[model samples]
Target: MALALAAPLAACGGGSDDSGADQESIGLLLPENKAGRYEAFDRRIISSRLSTLCLECKLEYRNAGARSDIQKRQFEALVNKGVKVIILDPVDAHAARSWVDAAAEKGVQVIAYDRLAEGDVAAYVSYDNEKIGRLQGKGILDALGSRAATADVVMLNGSPTDPNAPSFKKGAHEVLDGKVHKIVYEQDIPGWTEAEARKKMAEAIKDLGAAGFEAVYSANDGMAGGAAEALKSAGLKNVPLGGQDAELPALQRLVSGAQTFTIYKQVRPEAETAAEIAFRLLRGKSIKSLTPETADSKSKTGIPARLFNAQIVTKDNMEDTVIRDGVAPANWICTKELAAACKSLGLN
Candidate 1:
């Protein structure tokens, strides 16, 4: 279970002593790269913010590649390396209890990032996951319009191991249960794999026929891409599809009418918040100011937490949200094939 570590990011310029005794190390362990946000936004933002916060601090980062065993090993390695604070977005939130407990035994602090990890964590940073789900359900309703009254829907949920997945599903059901005609098919995808999503979506189409479902609710953008491909292969047209994480391709799909909408949880602020908390914790400062709210996991209660809000992104508000915030720049989403869609949306 030994992980191949990436080189630690050393902060540039000097404000504090650069000697080994004066240096501080913080570890960031993210769950997976399939969603792209971890590597694309979270890692960079957290690293930069930490550099700004502590000029002599070193950031050690590791990605589990969606394997809990790998993440467990990485966590152990960081603790062994004397990293006093670790920001962990667990690949399997349930499996994190022992790891977090072991870290605590060694006097290490754990900050649950994005997804809540079980055990005694110093702080938690993430979005209102259930609200994201409600917005996703609303996206489907909005796309369905008049047809929502009798429309059949398919639900493609996220990983069962991810703690946030259930909240997302619960929120979506709250919004869609009585309002929609029926939920014809539902599957909880493991690891949020796009291929698994595609296979399940194809299976649903096979069992229910091409016209069986009127819309699809993918838990995140990565799965939405798979669902889109399956829909296209089945020759299913204009079946409203919604997903979370307004990723670049998802935003492109939104403009092209392939995806109805996506949930954009501003990642920079979330990453920065985690970074700031880690810095404060390293400096022995109280984080009560940063964490105004509280969260509870199965193993622990009343944990200090900071939850950000999410927005539903569609073709109409592309400019106002993701583009304006620079989460996904206009040029990044406005590729050559999507130029017409971009121009029509005034993005070009």
Candidate 2:
């Protein structure tokens, strides 16, 4: 997760004693790159927006690669480098409390991004995760149709360390507990690793006899890919599967009938919002207008937050959702193997 550091900012003009007299620095620390969006979208958008917002401000970025230790070191590095504003998507939200506390002691402001980190954070920006889970649950139900009442579902939840994971699981359970026959088996995959998800799914298939569950509800698209492989290898076909994060592969899967649905949370606005807030904080301006809602973490209450809504993406709505938003273009999604599927879905 170590990246070559960007060139140092130019020395302040007029040799001012105050470091903020001319050049300012803002840090963006993301949780991991495995999800693809962090490097492909969030980092690029946030960096571009920050440059546009402040010409003299420098952006220092890092990705933890799902390692909390690396993240803690990165956070400390930013603080020691005199970065006053930091946008942090923690690898382990709970472990971030001490980091936030240390940053606060150094007069630093931490804006929790995507994942809500514990401790006294200045702000948080993410999708309504619980509602996202509800959408996921509903997607499974819709795919199941009449069989939903008798369906036993296998739930492949996200990392135990991520704060958002519990909320997603809670929201999904609220919708799925009574609607489906029962949750036949559920496991929280650590670090949100696709390989672990695949291993767990294989174990589920072995124990459940391949026919015990009627559907698979994966917390995100990456894990869905793993579960899909396990299902395919076990020759379990036609069982409904759903996930969040309308990633390109997941969209293609939807077209090929490998995955039933995915939740699309527009990441551009989310990244831009974080950049705007960071710029405001750098200028000592108010972020009240940007954050209209409040959220609670384990260590803090009434923390200002901006939560975006998510949409369920299916083969039927490809044109209206991810395609309309320009998240993934038609050409990018429709490969030679999937050309027919794309045409039949009106994606061409």
Candidate 3:
């Protein structure tokens, strides 16, 4: 993989540390508020990890709402306000390069979050995006079973501007390449927004010509929900759909048989690891040896990165994955309405 690094502090729309001394604040910029996990997990885990390591550091947080323009503007704002180290998950990888360039120019370090940003960064952290796509493809194929070669799967991919989108598509295509029957609809949802997904999926159903599609391969849980809604409108019953991020709603849908499975990336480990990297960078320390893998970006070469493993999560195995990993507990999923289902699944 080729890496492109653009840590331009000037193009960041003014978010950089202009203070005379070395005192630094850590700015954390996430992509969107639409995904529940960012607020529910990523921010808390990263902050907690940072706090555990040191108390002097300050964490500045912001959301981009799946818009590259907003992110570019926000990046400038953070730098202008004077943050020492920036942890950014790009809203649009390529568009982010200019802002990243600006940050680099200001001498403030930038760490690429879960979603890999284009260009040079202090450090990069994320799961194997290709593996996620492969898992999703395999899960959908496995669900199709005898119909794997016969079924027409609709591909609901992630944002076009996001670098993960193509990697995910590549991973999935590796499994689905020649064996699958057909791809009636292959579309990338912008910003991973539910509304966009819903609209695109409806258009797909119309394009596929009513009841012509069999299964769906959605990149994440949010789009999966949108695809599910579109399928509901089409009045199709029991066609397997794939998703990632074992979100509460997706888990419920799996239990109800509306969805087939999801790719569960142990988020805590990623967030914790990122926190550690950011803190270490803040201390002016080296983090090269700590990373287990090397990721290539367009602007930079061989950036040391942490790539976590992704697991397949289904209704039957949620206990073994999320429950065992402490990512989620039975209390939330095993509510009064789902008490029987929880018991049936052997989760107390």
Candidate 4:
């Protein structure tokens, strides 16, 4: 819970501060604790890689708990500790602009992790937002099979507060707009929680009825599972659902025929990329190659960004994608209950 603290990164490899001292402490700020991947897999991979790259470089980890004010305080805490660099996933992107400016004023490099901040970040690392949505939208059509043309789909979007959520929605709409016959219901769930998604989906189920909806477009795997739950509660069957993030439970649901598809964004490489960029910046090295293009937020213009592609993973290709990439273990996904399901779907 306390961010799985480890030895300084400089201990594994030779590293020093800008003044050529031995110790190089880097602060890492993760956005929230709601999603399990942030705390466990992402943090672990990033911390280990940073340590390996900058031996004796300390990684101070803190969680923002999805509050902008809390994240601001945590950023100050890291700054007060005299860290050379801070990698942060902003809880609120627009609101966190001031923090980035503050860190810059104090001569600390800020690497915007996962989510892009409003101001000019030192370096940004995340998957292609629009592409992620495109993959999710295409997944829905593919899962619908012959019904792709006629399926009535419902969109369960994420919070309006999160910038990434809208970006994802835009991407999905790109592939789906004007293609499907009818959009029976479209609602953006406020909290981005499974419970809220389920409640809203239940209402959709009520408004549109079982026969009316052929598919549901849930933004992430968590909400995808929620939509599927609502469908099952309504005693429905064969409804194609779309999601991303390749979560363990959602992947299992895929194998068991409870869900349709989820996108697999390679995390280790993404995190490692961010870590390497952060260290390179701390050493006052140029990172022009790392950036692909310039992205504009509400407040800032032409912010440098490093964007990666996302892969689509359906039930048929889970083994070859998420499992093969070591995002999740085989034992965790292909369980006893999903044994026959796995074999049926060619997952094993």
Top lDDT prediction, candidate number: 1
Alpha carbon lDDT of each predicted model:
0.88, 0.87, 0.81, 0.79
Q: What is the number of residue pairs that collide in model 2?
A: 0
CA displacement after TM-score superposition, residue 37 of candidate 4 (Å): 1.7
lDDT of 1 by residue, 116-196 (tens): 999989999999898988999999999999999899999999999999999999999999998999999999999898999
Any runs in candidate 4 off by more than 4 Å, and if so which? Answer: 1-23
TM-scores of all candidate predictions against the true structure: 0.94, 0.93, 0.90, 0.91
**In what order do the candidates fall by lDDT, top score first?**
1, 2, 3, 4
Question: Residue-wise lDDT of candidate 2 within 1-348, one digit each (tens)?
Answer: 012112222321112122332228888899888887888788877877777787777777888888999989988877877889999999999999999988888789999999999988999999889999899999999999999999999999999999999889998998998999999899999988789999999999999997889999999999999999999999988889999999889999999999999999989889999999999998999999999999999898999999999989999999988887677888889999999999888897
- Clash count in backbone of candidate 4: 12
Please give the lDDT score at residue 6 for candidate 1.
27
Cα lDDT tens digits for candidate 4, 73-95: 87777676677688889888888
**What ranking emerges by TM-score with the best candidate at the front?**
1, 2, 4, 3
Best of the two (1, 2) by lDDT = 1
What range of 10 consecutive residues in model 2 has the weakest lDDT sum?
Answer: 1-10
Flag the better candidate by TM-score, 3 or 4: 4
Model 2: lDDT of residue 132: 91
